[model samples]
Target: MSERETWATRAGFILAAVGSAVGLGNIWQFPFKTAEFGGATFLVVYLVAVFGIGLPAMLAEFVVGRKSNLNTIGAFERIGYRNWRFVGVLGLLTGFWILSYYSVVGGWVLRYVGGSLTGAYFGDAQGYFGAISAGPEAIALHAVFMALVVGIVAFGIQDGIEKATKLMVPSILAILVALAVWAFTLPGATPGYAYFLSPDLSQLRLTVDTTPSFPWLTFGGPLAAIIPFAVSQAFFSLSLGMGAMITYASYIDGDESLFGDSATIVVFNTAIGILAGLVVIPLLFAQGVEPGSGGAGALFISVASAFADIPFGRVVGVVFFLVVLVAALSSAISLLEVVVSYAIDNYPVSRPQVAVGLGSAIFTLGLPSAWDTAWLTWFDTLAYQLLLPASVLGILVFVGWVFGRPGVEELLRGTGFGDGVGSLWLWLVRTVVFLGVVLTLALGLLTLFGGADPAIVPPL
Candidate 1:
């Protein structure tokens, strides 16, 4: 058997983990969701979800990975829960499922980067997206994006994943901050800031009377709906429940502060998410365009149009799309890594072979998404609304019940914390986090099957 590859340094592991967490969701989906919902209220609820639910659930995955020092499925096996290995399988499948469509979107971002450089999408942002969004061109772009992801993962953990992320994550942060600063300088940017930062309590108030509803079902109402959405966003934004964190944590070699590391990753991810809103919302407002009005093309059309209308538009467009490209690649690498790590651990295959093989498979699966808009929407709804949240709920159950006190002990192993802190963490996981995942899963299913509007459910 070959020796397991480990992250070369603590910082490398954190950067890789942050790279996994900070993806298109942080840049595009989060801002759109916030704008679509009551922005400030949604932001406040999302913060609560991040600390209350996201942190504990993340710690649970970290405990399994670091304690067992194995791949996702093997981590469960090492923890003496043979049947629970299926949870890891679900996590792997969730990552693959998401990346299948995610890579298709990443391909769009890549195409836009080139288009932006040449000012191809400058005048007609919507038309440019329409021209490249489907058919053979989209497939070819998808292949190119998948190839970049495969190339990175094929080099194994230290040489490929860590080094690439070390450069990409820092670059992503810098570009986002720069863009936000530039965006604020625009004439009408203050309204955007007000829309995003100022809470409207009236928007959050439930006007409809609900006297006889079930307590759980009562949460389905307008104001209450934000809770589940916030929880789902926290899970998605942290890259939890997809085996990415578990796989990344498995590469850590020494005793380090898991709690502190998780905190840093969360803080960076949330800051970037909010910063992306700052950049995107203000720019759109400056152009007299409403944020998130472009639906799935919110980032592509609305933001691109705003860029085209600005001074030095071409340069800004190029830089913005470049940032998107880097963020997309960083995330796609982690998604592919989840499947590659499982294959290398279980099968007698080389890393390069597995990376290529799995990359090809996912790209083929994503072709339908690249070919048809309806297919793309269905894929996103399936992966984000159902599979991802379902997988997360399973993990919450396992850590809270099956892993129990032993899991808490593992979580506290390197944190220099006592049992009291560990117990508090465990309590939150078993109670609040567990319920949060359950509600997120339920809300997602309601959106998919119960004929609920996505605007209300807000796909995480």
Candidate 2:
């Protein structure tokens, strides 16, 4: 029998997890990254990444979660050697680091949610974003954001996040799609499409002798960029390489097909992400907004500005920002749920108390991120570099090396994929996924310490 908590219904479970995956990353971050990176070509690379990097890595998490049916740390302990416990602990720390900045960003969204109603950031959007993005004002908003997340976690999994998502995800999707539809009707979209969809040819000039920069910006530059982008995107999109999914899976019941449900979550998440790009890229393209402003607050600022100049823009602004507000909360609830689930599963801490503790901690730590964008970048880098790679590597080792092939194969068999998973996957888990993760970790570490030209380091 599966030990993790299951959703009261299949619909609740899929929607809740999808709610977690389909958030600011897809909506807010996707448009900005595409524009900033190289437009349509980058999107092409990213979509490839979604399939190769995200799909496989996601399956790995599903297998681990459904099999063990325990909270992160506990899941590791239950599966393999005592040392595996450290992996789980590391995952917890990873989540903590991510949540610190994530909560701050969440607050920024909350701030906009409130501001959109008043058009406070509507005029001179760039300057307004600069003024409020990092400071005491940001801190206050972060606290409010953390409080909302804590409130949901306190309410318990199936009861709170599931219910909230049931309300939030649909609204988030509806608004974004509507916005996309609106964006298509406008003009000046050709350049935006060219920049985002058509690949620039010059970036492809680099060959083996010369190093490439922004290859996707050029036509047929590096097919390799697709791998890192996809891997990283998968990590970001699934919210995997972190403990969130493990925590959610810990609460799942065994009778249902974990694979089937997880697939639904991934597809829904991808759709939302694509839809967000639809809203963002076309809008900016149709307007004459400079693509240079694609920063963290770019989406919030740009989208609001776009709406402000349009007919009936105020209502549109409110509707669009509300989409972001809901998306942020959905993901925030997942992050909060990680800790809250642990408290309920492992300790006698009442659900409400669990929420209070985790929420307070997130709010407090989130202050630094809110008040300092530098700190936010640091936390994101650390989470992605140190915590994620290490944790994923640790999991491969635990399942492949520690638990051995038989144990893992049994878990895969637990699903309807049946014996079709077979010896090949077992071999891959042992050799490819496990070894590949270690190498990726090494490269990530190297990138952290090894490469640094004077221009990059001092930014002269």
Best prediction by lDDT: 1
Regions of candidate 2 where Cα sits further than 4 Å from its true position:
1-5, 199-230, 404-415, 422-424, 427-443, 452-460
Please report, in order, the local distance difference test score of every candidate based on alpha carbons.
0.84, 0.69
Model 1, span 83-184: residue lDDT tens: 999999999988998898888888899888888788888878889888888889999999999999999999989999999999999999999999999998
Q: Report the C-alpha lDDT of model 2 over 228-298, residue by residue, as the tens digit.
A: 33345556667776677777766666456665776788888888887887778878877788774646667
Give each prediction's root-mean-square deviation over alpha carbons.
2.2, 4.5
Give the poorly placed runs of model 1, Cα more than 4 Å off. 205-219, 454-460
Task: Give TM-scores for every candidate, taking all chains together and pairing residue i with residue i.
Answer: 0.95, 0.87
Q: RMSD to the native, candidate 1? A: 2.2
Model 2 scores a TM of: 0.87
